[model samples]
Target: MRLAGIHHVTAITADAPGNRRFYTGLLGMRLVKKTVNQDDVRAYHLFYADGIGAPGTDLTFFDWPVGPRVPGSHDLVRTGLRVAGSDALAWWQDRFARAGVAHGPVEERDGRAV
Candidate 1:
């Protein structure tokens, strides 16, 4: 099947409030939607993204309290956000640094970053 782009990426989280704080407050993504998971009515499904809740910009979480953490097995992978250009990368790097968020040093990649 051909895909135009990603709709969203969903992840499991243990703490809903903490997740909300990190994504919305710290990361500066808008809390687009707050809802209950369909299969598990009590659990939450949170969506965060830029303005207007645009697709491909969303980062979603499913509250799964019983799930145990599994480390060192690639269970968690990094998510990369694509910025507009070198200027955007520079601006983002500065913003992240000021917020004390640890991120990789900016580097030239495919004619971007620089």
Candidate 2:
């Protein structure tokens, strides 16, 4: 069997408002929908994506106010999104700096500088 690629990724956020601001305001992603979790109506399930919220462009978040991770607990390490061209990385680097988003310098990964 073979796989094509990731369709979407979900994450937990302690501060939903801040997460929304960061992704939509800072990173320039569009909010596809603002909805609540089906199982837990009190929590927010925010879906963000490109301008039109394409299939593979989804980045979602679940609102959970768990205070910080306990020591030695398993946690999400990293998430990456691919841009169309090398120029996009350069643009993002500048955007990150301007928006005060901490990001590492683009380095070679899988034979491409991402």
Candidate 3:
């Protein structure tokens, strides 16, 4: 059996407005959809993606009131997104710096420049 790449990822966020702003404004992802959660109507479900709303590039969020996660071995910690090349990485690093976005230094990981 073979596995294809990711179609989308769904995560929860306590601050929908901030999340939307960061993803759309800062990172340049598109807001593909804004809808209510199916089972929980009060909560919002937001979909973000690349241009034209492509499948694999999409990220979904469940807007809910929540607290900081308790760090543990079993829980998910971070999400890593990719760019095209080292030049792009440098450009993003500069952009982040100029925009005052807090980020770690860009370094090579697993033979790939990030």
Name the top TM-score candidate. Answer: 3
**Better candidate by TM-score, 2 or 3:** 3
For all predictions, the C-alpha RMSD in Å is: 2.8, 2.0, 1.7
Model 3 residue 44 lDDT score: 97
lDDT (tens digit, per residue) of candidate 3 on 2-93: 76898899998989999999899989999989999999999999999998997699889999998778777466757788889888888989
lDDT of each: 0.84, 0.89, 0.89
Show the lowest summed lDDT stretch of 10 residues, model 1: 66-75
Question: Which predicted model would earn the best lDDT?
Answer: 2
Give every collision pair in model 2: none
- For candidate 3, which ten residues in a row score worst on lDDT? 70-79
Cα error of candidate 3 at position 45, Å: 0.6
Where does model 1 exceed 4 Å of error?
66-71, 108-114
Cα deviation at 15, candidate 1, in Å, is: 2.8
Candidate 2 RMSD to the correct structure: 2.0
